[model samples]
Target chain A: MTETRGEPDVEAWAESGGRERAAWIGWVTFAARLGLAGVLFWAGWTKFTEPVVLQRQAVDAYQILPEALVGPVGVGLPVLEMVLALLLVVGFATRLTAVISGVLMALFIAGIASAWARGLAIDCGCFGGGGPVAEGETKYLQEIVRDVGFLALAVWITVFAPGRLAVDRKLGL
Target chain B: MGKASRERSARERIAEQRKLEARRDKQVKTLAVAGGALALIAVAVGVVVMADAGKDEPAYTGPLAPTSRQDDGSVVMAKEGVTAPVLEVYEDFQCPACKGLEESSGNTIKQLAAEGKVKVVYRPFRLFGQDPLKGNSERAANAALCAPGDNWIKFHDRLFAEQPKEGKVGFENADLISWAADYGVSGAAFESCVNNGEKGAQVQAMTDHAFNTAGVQSTPTIVLNGKNVTDQAWSGDDLAKAVQEAS
Candidate 1:
């Protein structure tokens, strides 16, 4: 009312035509970072709530890791996931965390693909914890696709951890 | 346009540049310190989980408990002259989760039996009724039935250790006989018994009794004192605790 550009926000409008586009991009990255964090948090929390044996058995179903390594990975992976989610939520070292998140999702995709290729009828015991094995329904493709989506979101945050409300922005990261 | 104005503008530009460099420095320092702290926390959690996850079941090697095969093809191992609660294990060798359950709780069950705290009855059956997985389960269950009484538990443990990937062909008859031979259980009779599928009928009967009569629809099921406690017992520690509470 005092003396606008006959518009609501005069300062931003006067700056450059690209400012609005850049602002949109920032908001998009912000949404992505938080979305990825929420999914990771849910993934980690679900594992925490399930019986440890279910996770252990799920990891064993992959049959990739050595017998000695399976137990520790199954036990530690969810906790690490939760910590990473917390970091992503706070945007602390966001690019680094997103890279890690992307890598984790990539590994999951690879494991699922390998299982599918080998005709292993076993199900992955992660994410939601493999429920009872349903005959003739591995659903490997669906799992891989969902993980790919998560991977995309992680890549978004890695490329542009925007200055919306992130701690990284405050620290000039 | 004078020299003083130009110099003042130059000074302002330099100040702005300096502020940017200072902000970048702060970002680097903050990131390094915070990232290092996170890495430490992750590593600490990993080490602790590893310590907790990979616990070995103390193998009971003190003495041999008398084991006998019941008419239903179930092997019962209980020290004679000791009356204790019965802990029944219903498992299929080809079931992946069954292998996990055995790995996690097998030694505990054996120890309980060896200590005469519980009577262990291993009921190996074919949980898989479909092909791919079905054949392996049937062969392994039949082979288990053919194992001699004294070393039956050893044979049982060996089968679990040698389990193949789900839907894979495994527990071939020759390997079954060889495995028995390693346990000092080999002979022409044992080989013929395994090759000819002599215990196939027994295995089939046991599977039926387990699924239909015993109401076991899943592998790696635990029955302690005639009550299914599989929901509560997932590890050696869990097994030990549940048995203590029940018995």
Candidate 2:
């Protein structure tokens, strides 16, 4: 394709240190994607190791979803998390995976916010094994902050489209 | 020579463009397939787990069981002539606080039941500890359900008596069987019942009932006439007063 008059010139930009800047963004994106993947994998693995019933009960404690949906949501969530983590790690379908990750995080944030608002003393169940928290042990603020941080990473990956060492690069994504 | 070479170069550029387009199409196709497969696998896992949800073990048909089982899977103990209001006690054996409740007021409550002053209904609420499936709370609840009500109560007391610290594997399967024998619930049939964990499903159901139906969250939840009197823990006099007030 021919560059328009006002369009940035790749050759000229490279001569003006744009190469180092692009590499810098690529490396940062790579690190953020890897970090998010690691977090999701660890969280999913913890929940996976526990019984599916435990997960169900944890969701039941939330009392947010209808009883029928609880079973499917509880069981599917950790598996989905692990799958998304795997794709992110391998850099396959990075943008799509990031969108899913963002959606999940947003749902979680809403769940936590409601629980906090309602004065329900329950664990967020982010990693695994959550239920009613004992009196004076709720950590809603910290959990929300952490999830928001992860959501930020998800948004960044989705928008910036990290390329270095990614399957997306090879696939012309 | 120059004209022929230029013409060949132009043809090569067109071929290269076709290759790039083909590669892009193939990559999109692969990604779509991979994404779809991953989603299908996730849905399959969820369905399989949900299918496994209601898999109850064979119902308990052993001896010394409850005379009347509640609809929510809890066992009821009603003295022959007791006409007093029912005192529903929700407890988990692995809970130290539950043990504290039992140690301080277990005898008082049993005496009340013995005297027919109050019909104490013991419900196994297995909310204590981390592991939902293999936790001591579930194991002890399962063992208790296998035994008859009278023997179960005896075993229940002994369980609290030998309650291990939280976050520890105190109720080994073999040890549970042996303890049942000590509580006068012995023999091969009883041992097999405990070992096989036939009432595993019932225990799980009871746990769910405690949470979903009864709305009881923690252990040692004393309900007098369906009103939670957990504030009256560790004090027999206070619990008795509350029960009296309720009646």
Candidate 3:
């Protein structure tokens, strides 16, 4: 009787193009969530394990914050990134986390752009170990492009957050 | 439509609206709690860090011994003609571990020098080979050179107090000049000396001598009576013992 309408195992379900498209979209979003989580975890863990002295230096390389703010921002950013990654892993408040992650990526892109504009040849410190690079070694374009790719993934998760195996779906979020 | 059927449909729509409201409320509450938790954790960590970093040294107000600038861009502080153990402290302004050494042993060394118990030689050198870190070390060393012998010690302490993070542009000429004023070491001559980098070559020579000739390859390398007592002189208490044992 259920097959008369549209059983998942039957041909009737294949007739709906919208369902197929949505299934594909769900899979892509799920992949983005994990990919974003992996990148964020790595970024956070690298800085967390490094000495605070180095992290402070890396933050100073940005040259955006005041000297007074440098210590706190340097110390806090890594932990916050890890927390966001955990939240993504559990798929709780995923859309919100993606939006926050996207904003962070945008800020990073802006900082790199500002540094490039100011003629400073410092490393972006995305994964830690920031400072002056050797001559002809500043990869401003590459850093920006990579961050933009992350931003795109973030956007995808923000739009399609209720993907497969997400806690959001289990909770009816 | 019949009244009974219309009434039933209206009731169903109301129930659906309530269910949607409940879901929205739950999502908002969940997000709010999560965001709040994240913020609390971050702020707590920041506070802990700030508290730890804010322990600055009180200014040394005791009698300072006579200081003489050596030809090799080093400042020696000791009683005139007093033959005592030489505590040659090799430091770089940009190095954090050097800052640690200053925090631990700086006061003890000053006290020993004041008491004529030891001949303390403050040798600031460029440990970093690259810019902008190398640049910071050189500038701070040059600024120390510009300060007259006794003032150089104060400049040394001041540089450590506000030691910038590595990989940053620090020890700007203006800041260098201003720091000297804190110890009455300011004048047009001093300002011009800092701005023109008058002791730039001397700093380079000192760095070369420190690295290439002295064979010292790290910051906070304290050579006591020609013996490296750095490990023994880790703290003020340890430094005093080391100095006494060496004597």
Candidate 4:
């Protein structure tokens, strides 16, 4: 006696292409986010363990935003990085997390670029002790450019993917 | 069944479907927003931590006479000079870890030097002895030998301070010259030594001697009181103890 749109038209819903497109985008986003998160998490952990070394390098490069903000940033960055990394791996808030990651990567690239431009011969301090350089050397432009590319990928994830396999999707959002 | 009854049933079914869809949508949106907020907060925390890290700059409070050359290439000593145990270290200009040791432990060494507990004499060794032209090690060594009176220590410090981490060649002549100028060394003299390879043979002989006679196999090999302690893992304290014992 009642018409119910024939089980919500499963074939039609699947054929609209949104689901397929989202799947593809979601997978790509997952890979990129996971990769970036892992790298940042490693780097952040190293720095957190050796805050003194990182702080010294940062000051040497003159990358600190302001003289006053240095101490707090050093202490808080590692915990933050670990949390974000866990979120990304778990596919929690994938799009938003990707965007944040992209922004952070962009900031890092900018910092490296500025240091290179200024000829501050110091390590990037992205990773902890005994970096690619022995010490007292600036990161090259090539490394910064590579980061820019990664940042672009992250931004792509933010725009196209909606974290299909994430908690959001599980919640039916 | 009556037509009205059928119509009423259809309306009820439609309402139930709409309600379910609305609930699902709400759940998804909430999850998305909440997860996103958590990630953003993590990023925010990371940025803040990095920012705060810049505050604890290591201070060089050692009692070394802060020596810097004036514009006219005159050496100026900040504190009264003292007699100390002597330790001569021969190093290459382009060696990366040399730079690290210098930045990390240079002040501590200087403090020891200033206190008359130790004296550090840096002998330059050219690791890139194969390429005589662009070899930073040879050029730096030559410059130091040519202008030892004015630029030896300062030039030594600057070289480690500005050495490139890794590359095809070492610092260019221009960079070396500028660095020499920073220490009040005569740029012309530094350039000429670098160009002519003034201390090429001496540096080679010293490096060879270090290997053959002193068994020094590393850039940071330390000579404690004329005895080559190359094999031992020598720290500042170790050197201090050796010096005290020798004295």
Candidate 5:
């Protein structure tokens, strides 16, 4: 099959530098995929048990979105997070999921930044239960930094496709 | 290049095209299945959420009195003697700042109310439901409204006095019942009302009023004659002075 089929380009590439590079990329991809999956899983799972109420409060506290948008965002965000987590964990449509994950992280970073700039004294509500932070307990800087770190992981996964053990690769994405 | 090699390359190109098409087919199939699964999960979650949104709250049949309810169903803590110039004090039961505001100026406000100087209406405003405190503010507010007649004020004051510390459970049903008893607001009817959460709707309605209608962002927002006095620290004689000025 190897002789009959058209894979000389792959063979030649493998012979040159592709084998070592692919192996390196695979390990990095695996680690990045698992890392982001763990984050989304933890974040989404925390809110799932409690359901929509606190999530709504968190959304309201941002004070950025319109009233009409609040209910849908509050109800839908955690579900999306969990769905994205599942996709990331199983490495299905890895590039698409990773891009989404990156977008979410970027949004979180922006939200926290805006809240901090506005002197809102909010809890970032990244995992859940976000509203006005308890008095004198504002941690906006730390929240922003952590979200930035998550954003970096997401960006890496987006670019590299996380091909190792990924359903995307199996489907030749 | 030789003819044999050229032919082999052409054949390889055809095979590559076939492989690419097969890969695309697989990808399309995977995306379709994944999208369907995601939609199914989303629909399931939406249904569950919608079902929970339907409150099992029993009707507020506990007690009835001559209390004035605002447009949004928030009860106005209306006294008989005072008629004009409503002194609206927006407060949350669990908010520490509100507790402070009440502690500092509660007496002055009560004295003014007794004197019929200003009709003080304690509007229930909630915050901190999403935190570890959960829905305690809303629950306490509900319990306050559920208190029979003039007993709501007493219940309101006592709640602030025994207001739990920040980042803690503010009040449970049993605690509310016991406190109501302490404030001479006890009975089987009242207990049933609190337990059954009959006034939960009223509580939610009032909270929405404070947030949406009144544009109340935080607790302890003091308004006299519809003028906001939230910026001023009316800690001492200033509170009485402000009330007097409003009149």
Candidate 6:
């Protein structure tokens, strides 16, 4: 599969297909990262705007964890989410960013699941306040299921594709 | 040596290598920039959307100080110790927000009740009356009423804690029995009361009183010191201030 003159080896290149495959994967990575970043950014923004609601959620979570850690975790989660969203969107250390997003989604799923299991009728507060959990309605299971799907997509991008057309690669980092 | 031919070959090779390197670099840079830009846009959009969504939510402007009936069929208001304030709460057991109010403010109200500063009255309304088999408001009210002595508060809290959200499906007879066991109440007594529709009339009367007499329109319509506190922003601090003023 040798090419004439300086042209790349078409047949060998076709067999390896590293560049072409990367390009295709890049598009997938781009779309997934964008979608997930949007979701995280929105969630973090909600927490930031309504600190009280976030505090309530944190306190509810506190019931499941050590009291000492609740305040710090509550305050840190939104900020951390913002940073992760930025990282994912900007293509800064893409694989690392995707992993962080995946982990956060997993944690969110766990939190909702635990709250449901404990029979706590509180809002998930993934997006800030609406109303408390109404009798006979458990939104947690659905929420967890959604997060699982997002996590799967994130993991796929993290492992197989470089964040398509990101600044990190542009900066040669 | 064929100096001319060798020179041309060397130049060509160098030029080809440089072009290949440049192409690779350009592709990499383009990919990186595009990815980064997309992420940033997503984050920005997310932030705006989330903020808007938060704003669209309705603020909780319902009752501040909630009151409930004790097992002895006596009205227990938190203002007894807090002041001469009268607190009335119209609640539905199946309502999730009512449950939140119960969990969050139950202790504070209990303290006020013990102090005998506030007069609290609880009116139970059946919001989920549409569901006959699953709605637990009537049963919960009956169970609390049938509880022995001062076990009403304990039972009330337990009901809120165990109550499921709408659509999640609540406990059946067996589950309720287990929950009663946790509260040290005899399952048989609780079950009998629930099954026999005990306190059903009382619950109905109270709900009717709230709507017709008290002009209550919501599950948690609180009256502070005889003045209706419904539709007012009732935070913990606000409640304390109202108590101080009434005192």
TM for chain B in all models?
0.89, 0.67, 0.74, 0.60, 0.67, 0.63
lDDT of 4 by residue, A1-173 (tens): 57555523533443355977656656776677677778878977877666243444443344446635644654565666677677677766666777777888887787777766654445676675432332234446766877887787777656544444566567554
Looking at model 5 chain B, report the run of 10 residues with the lowest lDDT sum: B56-65
Native contacts present in each candidate (fraction): 0.34, 0.09, 0.10, 0.38, 0.05, 0.02
What lDDT score goes with residue B116 in model 1?
A: 79
lDDT of 1 by residue, A1-173 (tens): 57646332532442344877767767877788889888888887788666666777778777788978777777777877787888788777777888888999999899989987877776665575653354677888888899999999997777666437787778665
Using TM-score as the measure, which candidate wins?
1
Q: Highest lDDT among the candidates is held by which one?
A: 3
Error of 6 at A147 (Å): 5.8
CAPRI verdict (incorrect, acceptable, medium, high) for model 5:
incorrect
What DockQ results for candidate 5? 0.05
Error of 3 at A41 (Å): 3.0
Q: How well does chain A score by TM in each candidate?
A: 0.85, 0.89, 0.88, 0.75, 0.86, 0.80
Worst 10 residues of 4 chain B by lDDT: B70-79
When 2 and 5 are scored with lDDT, the better candidate is: 2
The global Cα lDDT (0 to 1) of model 4 is 0.60
For residues B1-247, write the lDDT of model 3, one tens digit per residue: 9999999999999999999999889878778756765675567566757764774444467988888888887989998876678999899888766776676567788888888889988888888777887788788888888888865677788998877754568889999888789889888999999999899889889888888887896767999988998876655777889899878
- The reply for model 4, stretches above 4 Å from the true place, is A1-40, A43-83, A99-173, B1-91, B95-101, B116-123, B127-134, B149-151, B160-195, B205-247
Q: Candidate 5 chain A: worst 10 consecutive residues by lDDT?
A: A5-14
Q: Encode model 6's per-residue lDDT on B69-175: one tens digit a residue.
A: 56435356453244456676677766555664554455555555556656666656665544531356666666656665444555666777787544455645556
Regions more than 4 Å wrong, model 2: A1-17, B1-27, B30-44, B47-51, B54-56, B61-247
lDDT of 4 by residue, B1-247 (tens): 9999999999999999999989887877867577567757756776665554553325456555554433322233333454345566656766554554565455656666666666556655655434422365666666656564533566767777766533345566667777777767665666788767776677767667666876766666667678875323123444556767755
Best by DockQ: 1
- The TM-score, computed over Cα atoms with residue i paired to residue i, of candidate 3 is 0.66
Better candidate by DockQ, 2 or 6? 6
Each prediction's number of clashing residue pairs: 0, 2, 0, 19, 0, 40
What TM-score do all the candidates reach, one by one? 0.85, 0.51, 0.66, 0.51, 0.52, 0.51
Native-referenced DockQ of model 3: 0.20
